[model samples]
Target: MKNILITGASRGIGRATALLAADRGWSVAINYASDAAAARSAAREVEARGSRALTVQGDVTDEAAVAAMFDTALDGLGGLDGVVVNAGVVAPSLPLAEMSLERLQRVFDINVLGSYLTAREAARRMSTDRGGRGGAMVVVSSAAARLGSPNEYVDYAGAKAALDAMTIGLSKELGPRGIRVNAVRPGLIETDIHASGGQPDRAARLGAATPLGRAGSADEVAESIVWLLSDAAAYANGAILDITGGR
Candidate 1:
C-alpha cells in the first residue's frame, strides 16, 4: 500500500486529509505536536478504513523531533509515497507594528521553519538520489499568503507566502528526480485555526464576501489535497491551487 505522512493530523485540515487518504487506500502516519488522544483517534479512523495507521508525536519546529518523526514513519510504514506539510499557527489579529517579536517568531517557527524541516526530511527520504522511491508533497498554504491579511495576521500571511515560494522552487528542483511538489491555498475554511487567531466566527462573517457566498469545510479542502497526491495529478508539479471559492 502507498504510505503518506501528514503533520498536524490530529484535527482540522490535517485530520480531514488523513481520513480521506486512508479511505483511498493509503497507509498514513498521523503526526501531531500534542494531544496524543486526538492523534490516536485519527489513526483509528484510518485503520477503520482498512489502511495501516501510525500515530507519531513531534513538534514540527524542533529539528530533532521532526527527524525522529520521519524515521518512525519510514520504519512503521515500510516506505513513504507522500507527505503533507500542514501544521501551522496564527496569533490574534494585530497590525504588523503592534505585533510582538515573540509572536512573529512563534508564527514563523511553526509555519515556515516547521514546513522546511518536514519537507527537507521528506526530500531526503523520497529522493531518487537517496536510493528511495520518488514521492509527492502537498503543502497547506493559505489564501492570506496572496491577500496579505493587512490588519489581521501579516506574520501568518508572510509565513505562508514563504511556503508558496518553497513549493515552486522545490518542485523544479525535484521534478527531474521524480518528486512532485505542490501547494493548496485555502481561504476562510471552517477550522479551529481561526479561533487560534482570536476569531472563531471569522469564516461565517467573511463567507458572504467570497463569490461562492460560504465558507469552505475541512472535507472540501481535503478532497483537493488527496487529488494532488494521486496519479490523476501526474503532471501537476509546482501548481499552487486555490481552494478559496473564488475569493
Candidate 2:
C-alpha cells in the first residue's frame, strides 16, 4: 500500500482525495491549517475506510512549518510515497487595478510560494537518490490559470499559472529522481473555496453555463488526483490536465 500526504485535507478537494486514497488502501497523513476539529474528523473518516490516518497542522506558506509537516507525516506514516499539493486560497472578486498589495501577497504567498515549498519538501523526502523510495506528486492547479479569471481574481489566476509552470519544471527535475509529477486544473468545483472567496454561490451560478451543465464535485477532481499518484499513470509526467467539463 502507498502512504501519502495531502495539504489542506480537512475538507474540500483535499479531504475528498484523502478519503478516496484511503479507500484504495493508502495510508494518509492529512495537513490542515487552523482547523484541528475538522482535521480530526477527516482522520476518523480515513480510518473508517481501512487506512492508517494522521493529521498535521501547519500553514503551507511557512518554510519551517512546511518542513515540520513533512517530518510529522513521515513519522506518522513511517515513510513517504506520495503528496498532493492542494492547499490554497481565493480572495474576493476584484479587478486587477482595484486589488490591494496585501491581497496580492496573500494570494501568491499561499498559492505560488507555499505550493513550491510544499512540493520541494516532498521531492526532498521522496527522491530515490535521497535514500528514499520513489513517489508521486499531484499539484492542484485551477482553470483560472488558463482562463485568466479577468476582473475577478487575476492575482489568483496568475499564481496558479505559475504553479502550472512549476509543475512542468518539477516533473522533469524529479523524473530523474524517481518522483512523478503531474497537475490537475480543476474548473468550477463545488467546494468551500467559493465561499472563502466571498461568493458562496459562484460555482452554482457559473457552473450552469458549463457544457456539463453543473459544477464539478470535489470527488470528481479527487478521483483524477489519486489516479495520477497511482501506478495506473506510470507513464504520465508533466501533464496539466483540465477537469473543466468542456467549459
Candidate 3:
C-alpha cells in the first residue's frame, strides 16, 4: 500500500485530503500542529476507511519537529510514497506598508521555509536510487499569488508565490531521480484559515470576484491535490494546477 504524509491534517484542506486519500486506500500520516484532539478524530475516520492512519504532532516551522514527524510516520508505516506539504499561516489583513516585519516573518517561517524543509527531507528519503518507489509532493498554494490580494495580505501571497516557484524547480531537479513535485493554487475556500487571518468575510469577497460566483470548498481543492499524487499525473511534473474557478 502507498503511504502519504500530510501536514496540517487536523483541519481544512489537509484534513479533507486525508479523508479522501484514506478512502482511496492510501495509508495516511496525519500531522497536526496543536490540535491533538482533532487529529485523533481525523485519524479515526481515516482508519474507518480501511487504511492505516498515524497522528503526528509538531510545529511545521521547526526543522527538528518536522523531521521527527516524518520519522514517526516512517517508523509506523515503514516508508512514505507521497507527501502533501499543506500546513500554512496567515496574519491579519493589512497594507504592505502597514504590515509588521514580525508578522511577515511569521507567515513566511511556516509557509515558505517549512515547505522547503519538508520537501528537502522527503527528497533525501525518497530518492529513486535509494531503492524504493518514486515519491510525489503537492504543495498547497493560493490564487492570491496572481490576484495580488491588495490591501489584504500581499505578504502571504508572496510567500505562496515562492512556494510555487519551489515546486517547479524541485519537480525538474527531482524528475530524473523519479520524484514529481507539483502545486495546487486554490481560490477562496470555506475554511478556518480566513478566520485565522482575521478576515471571516474573505470567502464572500472572493466569491464575488470569482467567475463561478462562489468560493471553492476545502474538499474541492483536496481532490485536486490527491489526483496530483496519483499515477495518472506521472507525466505532469513541475506544473501548478490551478483549482481556482477561472480567476
Candidate 4:
C-alpha cells in the first residue's frame, strides 16, 4: 500500500487530507506537535477507514525532533510514498510597523524554517539516489503569499512566499532525483487557524469578496493535495496550484 506522512495531521486541511488518503487505501502517518490525544484520535479515524495509521509527535522547529518524527514514520509505515508539509502558524493582526520581533520570529521559525526542514528531510529519504523509491510532496502554502495579507499579516505572507519559492526550486531539483514537489495556496478557509490568528471570522468576512463568493473548506483543499500526490498528477512538477476561490 502507498504510505504517506502528513505533518500537522491532527486537524484542519491536514486531517482532511489524511482521511482522503485513507480512502485511497494509503497508509497514513499523522504527525502532531503537542496534541497526542488529538493525534491518536485522528489515528483511530484513519484506522476506521480500513487503512493503517501511525501517529508521530515532534515540534517541527526543532531539527532533531523533525528527524525523529520522520524516522518514526519510516519505521511504522515501512516507507513513505508521499509527504504533506502542512505545519504552520500565524499571530494576531498587526501592521508590519507594529508587529513585534517575537511575532515575526515565531511566524518564520515555524512556517518557513519548519517547512524547509520538513521538505529537506523528505527529500533525503525519498530521493532515488538515496536508496529510496520515488515519491511525491505536497506543500501547503497560503494565498497570502501573493495577496500579501497587507496590514494584518505581512509577516505570515512573507513566510509563505518563501515556501512558494522553495516549492518551485525543490520541484525541479528533486524531480530528476525522484520526488515531485508541488504546493497549494489555499484562500480564505474556515479553520481554527483564524481563531488563533485573532480573527475567528476572517474567512466568512473576506470570502464574500472572492469571485466564487464563498469560502473554501479544508476538504476542498485536501482533494487537490491528495490528487497531486496520486498518479493523476504524475506529470505535474514545480506546479503551484491555487485553491483560492478566485480571490
Candidate 4, residues 57-121, lDDT tens digits: the string is 99999999999999999999999999999999999999999998899999999999999999999
- Cα error, residue 144 of model 1, in Å, equals 0.5
Candidate 2 versus the native: TM-score?
0.99
Please identify model 2 stretches exceeding 4 Å from their true place: none
Q: List TM-score per model, in order.
A: 0.99, 0.99, 0.97, 0.99
How do the residues 91-142 of candidate 3 rate in per-residue lDDT, one tens digit apiece?
8889999988799889899989998998888887787876656789998999
lDDT, residue 65, model 1: 98
Candidate 2, position 19, lDDT: 98
The alpha-carbon RMSD values of the candidates against the true structure, listed in the order shown, are 0.7, 0.7, 1.1, 0.7
Q: Candidate 4, overall lDDT? A: 0.95
Alpha-carbon lDDT, every model: 0.95, 0.95, 0.90, 0.95
Between 3 and 4, whose lDDT is larger?
4
Checking candidate 2 for backbone clashes, the offending pairs are: none
Clashes of 4: 0
State the lDDT of candidate 2 residue by residue for 132-243, as single tens digits: 7988999999999999999899999999999999999999999999999999999999998989889999999999999999999999999999999999999999999999
Model 2 scores worst on lDDT over the 10 consecutive residues at 123-132
Show model 4 residue runs off by greater than 4 Å: none
Candidate 1: C-alpha lDDT: 0.95
* Model 1 stretches astray by more than 4 angstroms: none
Q: Report, for all candidates in order, the number of backbone clashes.
A: 0, 0, 0, 0
lDDT per residue as tens, model 1, 1-247:
5799999999999999999999999999999998999999999999999999999999999999999999999999999999999999999999999999899999999999999999999999999998879989999999999999999999999999999999999999988887999999999999999998999999989987999999999999999999999989999999999999999
